[model samples]
Target: MTPSRFLRSALAGLLLAAGTAGAVPTASVPEFSDWPAGTAPAEVGRRVAENFAARSFQWQTDPKRRYVIYPEICAWYGALTVAGLSGDTALRDRLYAKYDVLLTPEGAARVSPDAHVDYRIFGVVPLEFQVQGRGDAWRAIGLTYADAQWGNPVIADGVSPEARWWIDDMYMLPILQVQAYRASRQAKYLDRAALTMAAYLDKLQQPNGLFLHAPDSPFYWGRGNGWVAAGMAELLRDLPADHPHHARILAGYRAMMAALLPVQGTDGLWKQLVDKPESWGETSATGMFTFALVTGVKSGWLNAKDYAPAARRAWLALVAHLDDDANLAEVCVGTDKARKTTKSDDLKVQYDFYQARPRRSGDLHGQAPVLWTASALLR
Candidate 1:
């Protein structure tokens, strides 16, 4: 057998022998059906999914030079998954049609050719399409980006060439690689994600179970940590229990969840700067945390009694923030890591930077997590 294939076979044998395969529950235990008005998972998911389908592609800069940005990719992926989970074929078809536009000459010109993490995450939408049985073409296209992530000869700390310790990469990088594994059933893709995650957990996870924006940036930026929480939940959902890195990944996920439980606001939201009482409630991080918590409780990775209520509270609270147009409010604007300006500046400067970020309604960054949380509830 080929080396990769042989390794996969060996892992399968180990899983079966150890009986850890299928040990983790894949479905929610309590089946979260008791949502308040306008808060039902399916109802909210469809609203957000439809919103994404009807919108024009978002861009980082000039509309003329537009390429699919990561935020759009995130919302698109969430919409596709929600369609499949809710069994809404019409919604799925609409999403597919939207993607088909990307294949046209005009649309193809808009696909970003950059090798950066944000650009590379565009691969996830196609990979999700492949998993939904769209076609072989998507699998082929998606793998190109996944493979290119590792194509650079230079490697840092034995992870992907794209690995930067920025907490956002925890979601951006792993979700793409995990989706590639789902589409292709390639163990290498899964291994790459696990290794990358372990490296991040070792470097970024703080003593309090939260993560900093970066090594030098010591503040608990909520959206940044939200990326880590959601990424770990996504990876743990698919990673085999027998994989060498599974235990460590699970430990990290559980630790983060435990830490998040106490800090959730009385209103069921988390703030832009999570640990700061003065920071305003932010929807993107709250939605991401809700998704992670709901997934954990459903998958039996967390005690339903402890996490289920928190998850439900978070979902309801998040939905309450949604407007008539399905736009979530109070989303923190996209932020780069806050760096120290001078030797005299303390960590409060970084904390203030996060608190001062403006909030917007209907941002894809916030919308994507709502869809994801909705899907988790339904799944």
Candidate 2:
């Protein structure tokens, strides 16, 4: 996360996202009506469920280049929540039972006992708490003091400032703290959430209406910001409507959604550079943004009349971006670390100069968001 490392990571992402101009997704999008009438939501859920079940992540064997914070819990939670809502009880049961291990000795350790400063904890709890009870999460915070390590002054990547941190942590942690606070009735969780937000809002926000992905990294990626947007919505849902920051949270989401609309490619996807699509484009970011806009409407945080069309448009764009297998192409895998050292060898090319070689789809950095997006799409 040093300055040198920042440039290399940003360049690596740029190299990977640069692609042959994809065909503009001008085909008239199939309507939701086109989703076979009477097609059970569970049907699609099962498809995604099977795909997620087959994927695995074991940190011990994983390379640093492949890491993202909360692969195991995020995938399981995304699979169940997105799939379960559709009445895919069987898949839901499997997912829930699969993750129920949180209560077991092994699963609890993965999400907790150390979640106070664990980045993964922020990402994991929403999916896990939303599915199972929040009991284990409460245990994690209760077992130890929250904010013991994270509150330390800036060290990695200047993320201690607001502008740089949002794209990375906002998507996961703040809301997790809110929920943990509510369950434990501990002030520390809320205190941590508020303190993080103050730092994030101050440094990351810009008049141009983008969150600094980080000080060293330059791309204002849609998925990363979208993670922040969606996380805020989820956080709002968890807090009492009377909370002082509630209105500010809605304003932030509105700003993000407005920022997204202008940069959307004619094809409905987002460019990797976000505002500068002529330079780069990516589907995963589009999907996450689409989810946020759509969910915002559903939650009454945004008006469907104003935002749903944009959401629908982005969904069609996302669908076109996916191949037959429901994967996002040109995703800067593990960016999912906006700031980390990138070796020169990371710049190897594939697609014959159209784009870098595809990282395996099982990559947690990509699948977690994809699963989260699919869940968003269904809801």
Candidate 3:
């Protein structure tokens, strides 16, 4: 059934199940009216980045939660990148101060060997520190994270050549792999990055060029796909022209961009469920997709005329969501996999679920990508 029909049916079903006609409260969802004019993409990016960087870098989470959380870690990366872009040394130093505890010998020791991959994302920060001539502690943590990933158990999926397929792996794994290669000049690091990414696309990428969140869970959650796009963009930036995976990765990146072009909302943002237009426009995914497209155009991997306009539109759309305080609106909080079963009675993620997911302002997931997008547009 068409998305609208399915949505109407789902809402009707929900109302019936509640045994009430008008009990469920509803709000008039706003649409993207018109985009702001004349602001350069880089400037728009700086506004978002500076607003984030100038803050205390605190998200009101528990102090203990600061050490290895993905959203916080990723947002710091964004702020750091923006500092590099805007030459905001004070902002950069503030970030270092905020996250300094994690860089200590004690903090490095806190990186548990058995920790899940999400925790290892902080490794990329240490690698960045090492590049700036910081002590070996950072490099040690990064390499350890890489080793754990290399030794991670492979799961059986008929199409994947290596381990299990998770869309989040796209962003989760690549930076460390690339940074490892940068630090060691080793092909193996690059090889692992490429092979796993290839395996993911092999199994999860749809014929139309978008990806399902996972092999078993077929939903295309917006941020999940954003991770893939943003991750591929990172990998492509570091991947060598002569490498075996270059052509395929380039093709996959371009294919995903092509798929995204036709679906951009009139407001220049993408829906929470990218393929589901009836869903609300999501800021984080929109920023990531904009960053990827702009990166592709900057790298000459995509036709400038064809892709740049859309990238600009998406960037402008993203800009509209950024409040004067620099908080991003309509960012979906961290999500888990939806049910895999195809039972007809299943309440699949449609308009309501996507819309109902929390809309927090200044979320790092939303914060980080605007920096990436700005950095991409800077070029």
Go through the candidates in order and give each one's C-alpha lDDT: 0.84, 0.52, 0.69
> Each prediction's TM-score against the native?
0.90, 0.68, 0.80
> What ordering of candidates by lDDT runs from best to worst?
1, 3, 2
lDDT of 3 by residue, 10-59 (tens): 44343234221111111111111223563565466567666765655342
Q: Highest TM-score: which candidate? A: 1
Model 2 scores worst on lDDT over the 10 consecutive residues at 20-29
Candidate 2 TM-score over all chains jointly: 0.68
Comparison by TM-score, 1 against 2, better one: 1
lDDT for model 1 comes to: 0.84
lDDT of 2 by residue, 1-379 (tens): 6564454334434433422122122122222224433232334445556666655446324554233245555556567666555666666656645545445665455443333333435344343444345346534643233343344535543222222344557755664555556556666565556556544544565545466555555556555676676666556555544555544455555666767777777777776657765645665566567657655665555545566667766655544444545554556554533334442123222111223323343444444555555565465
Candidate 3's error at 22, in angstroms? 58
Worst 10 residues of 3 by lDDT: 23-32
Error of 1 at 267 (Å): 0.3
Which pairs of residues collide in model 3? 327-362, 328-362
**lDDT measured at residue 218 in model 1 versus the true structure, 0 to 100:** 74
